[model samples]
Target: MPARARLCATVPALLPSSEADLPEVFGLPGRRLLAQRGDSALVVQALDDALVPSGGSVRVPAPWPRRRGTWAVAPDASLAVFAGVHAVRAVEPSGATRWEVRHGCWYGACRELHESYEEYADSKDHRYPEGGSAGFSVDGTFVWAHVRGPLAAGELGPDVVDEWLLLDATDGRVLGRADAGAAAAGSFHLPHPSDPRQMGLSIGEGQDGAPLRWGRWDGRTLAVEYVEGDLTLMSVSPSGERLMTVTHDQDALAVRDTGGSVLEGLEWAAGTAVPRHPDAEPDNDEALPYWDWAGGFVDETTLVGSTVEGDEEWGEGRHWIIDTSGARTPVEVTYPVTVGPQPPTALGDGTWITPAKSGEALYVWALD
Candidate 1:
């Protein structure tokens, strides 16, 4: 049976002040406008519905000196902002420091894990000068960071090797380290949603090893599990029973059992191209490619995605609601590209919230 959708509410026309990119909208229910102003990198939280700050805004102090990488919010609504070269800083809800670590990789030639609680109230906590990046667990109890191989500045090519370190959240302690040696490409990290202790590290083409590797941490021992295919993105279902992933080679979205068995595959519809604007010039490449299935289960068998067609001038991206019950045509939600991220909290409400790309604005949509 197809799940019914409702038109809840639309909070449209909330605009930002500057050119914003990388908008992360969290569904805090009553919480509105938790976004970053691109120009200032100011993490603002709006308390009231009136988008403009009549209610006032709080500025998140930058964790690192450099502006790169992304930020993640914990279930408790605390913020973890990543400064590429600087360590990951954990900010409390009351705007105080919970903890901070100065992280580094071997290739980067920096050493020392600087930990700070209330001590360095002024200075940021620093980690070892290795090339590894950090990821927080779902509960924010752990951080899994990967560091690349040793090399002087500009000397390390794409193929440089690296290591993965699992750290303790209470205090910045290296719980375990794994040898992730020489690879031909850049690596991306995906922490497993089901098992907070494990993470998937993907080393793209540059590496000489398998394209996909899943690392599992069992308290005292850490293990690396391999998967077949060029994995693009890996996310666990809200229920944590299934694994959802997209591959680089094909547009098909695959779902696997949490134990690593293939459950089903949904191929992108071929003729269903991105709709082009009426006044746009005709071109073969106009159909924007549908890539990156940022999917989460709508039900046990249904998944929803915010997809963009390859064509540059076509439609604002389209929403694909895929049904995996058997074989079926996925239902789609087509709207203006201005629609921010797809519904942040999928509680079967049929309504999703997307923050504007600039992080200045937010849009709420209810499926028709």
Candidate 2:
């Protein structure tokens, strides 16, 4: 049976202050929207219960181009941090650099401590260099960053290629550090909702493996626990007790406890949970559905997911709502209008956001 999804709001993408590029919208844990444009500026806006913008968007200057690396804004939207190829810089809205910490180069073989982006900005080797990411804690006091190893001279070790550092968000002071023990092509951070001391790190090593790490700071020391090797951490539940993850192969989705114990898991079987594509030939063995890499908890007991990638070859992608504590069955979600093939992103509220076909707006959906 199909469940009806209600249309909450059709929020237009934020107009960019920069020239030429379309703005991108990111849905944060809180009911907030961070619309970023080019590498020139960022606009943070809040959403009301109806999923509409609540007030004026706070625009801040981006420290570098968008293609450089990933970044995060503080919870209060007062500051923005850029995790660049050679340094992690904090920038204020007035385009002032509050502080910066230079680290080992993201380029695999380079060892020079670069003082500026211009040195290798045009180099062919640095064009596609692997990089790290940063995010601010919920309280906006601490910043958790995953970067290439060896913060300063003589700190390098044979096995330490990547390090996760905890920094003071205000002064950019390094408080604690831990060796991530992985050669990452890229990485990201997930902040704990209530506790500013704990955060999650997910690292991707291309076709090699996916590693999940959980970190905690005790105000004196930093401790990181290896969670799992083959799973990509998706969403943390509302109560902060459960986690949602999809297998690296996208074959299974599992609900696990905070300590990394699987509570419930479901796999895609054509005729059982996910239906066979109607456009596929009756005898075609190539038509199989796999889960998308995104999606999160709609609530503690239920979640919204999709088989968009697997469904793309046949036609429009499909979405679903899964019950975590019940029979673990998935019910297809039907929308009033057509949505793009991109995966649906759950807002951690009661709704989720999907991009418009034209890429100029976002539509928020909720179970009716």
Candidate 3:
């Protein structure tokens, strides 16, 4: 049996503090972070893999005005890009514009592209469109961007059939692209930590089997090898050989190969069958457990799991360490400090990170 480690909370000394209020802290790959205050997003980097923040902060002109848009940073942490209403825009550290790509917008009645951010933000539709899931690749060489297609049928027409594009990180030029042949309600990117040319795009259709598109970019052509159905990919293994996903309804956590074959499946009901707390569901009612929507690999075999379900014993949520190397077994772990109630994101490394609601700092944990 594996025992849980009680990790202590430590704030990155380099993280900038807003005098008025704590700014929003967002974790990026390569142990970097962003502190957002209204229209400005301050990009900060970690001094070392320990995730200790460094000195300089770059101010980025946030897209979407409010918190309506999500941003991604390039490899060297020089360029920052945000998903716009009908396009993706890359900006400099000084909040200057670099380039923008005009993709399709979501207004069904109006197929025209959005000229300004205000017009697109005003629409009450999917603020983040079915095709608005955009982010840069692992190596920061290309950006895998999702754009809405023309309106179709059966599932809202071509709009459901989104476009996945690979754009040059420097000029925002389309290098390779493909049509995601599914009704994507939501989507995300999973970049292979080791392989820069490979990545994964997951599209959620709000059911038991969302489509997972595995893409291979071989310099010239950017193509999807196959579409794996029925799983919401959370993160790829550090080795890039295996990828992890949550069951359609959060009933289980599964690991699969690059071919989309289920290598291991850890059912929540089976793992949480024995309740550690009195507030846990009764033995008979343990048919379902609310698994955190997002989690990441600590190394190649260990995973940090979180859940919003809790009782008087647990504050807002609970964290668990599940060994995915073999024979799935879950051990509950507790944080030394409070970081509010929200799903924690895996930082590709061995860190489990969550944002503080106060927007000032991040809560991070490590397994010993």
TM-scores of the models, in the order given: 0.65, 0.92, 0.82
Candidate 2 residue lDDT tens string, 1-368 = 78799998898777633352443344344456556555577667776656577888887787677788888888767888999998899988788899898888999989878889889989998888889999888788999999897776445476799999999999999998899878889988878877889888888888988888888999999998888657788887777777778777877777877677787454443345677667756677667677777788888788888888888899888888887777678888899988766788776677787877766678888899
Q: Looking at model 1, which ten-residue stretch has the lowest summed lDDT?
A: 148-157
**Residue 170 displacement (Å), model 3:** 0.8
Relative to the true structure, how large is the alpha-carbon lDDT of every model?
0.50, 0.79, 0.64
Total backbone clashes of candidate 2, pairs 3 or more residues apart or in separate chains: 0
Off by over 4 Å in 3: 6-9, 12-42, 121-131, 150-160, 207-209, 264-277, 281-287, 309-316, 356-359
lDDT of 1 by residue, 134-228 (tens): 66665567777655433222223344455566767666576776666534234556555446877766555432333556677889977766567
* Candidate 3, position 220, lDDT: 94
Give the higher-lDDT candidate: 2 or 3.
2
lDDT of 3 by residue, 1-368 (tens): 44444453445423344432233333344455544444445344544444555666665656655345455666567788786556678888777778787766644345766667777666667454544567667668888876665322112244355777788888988787677766556677777776778888777776635778888888898778564556678888778988777766666666678878777464444245324454555554543345756777777888776666533333356666777666567776765566656666665567676666555666666776
Q: Count the backbone clashes (under 3 Å) in each candidate.
A: 31, 0, 5
Query: Can you rank all candidates by TM-score, best first?
Result: 2, 3, 1
State the RMSD for candidate 1: 7.3
Ten contiguous residues with the weakest lDDT in model 3: 150-159
Q: What value of lDDT does candidate 2 attain over all alpha carbons?
A: 0.79
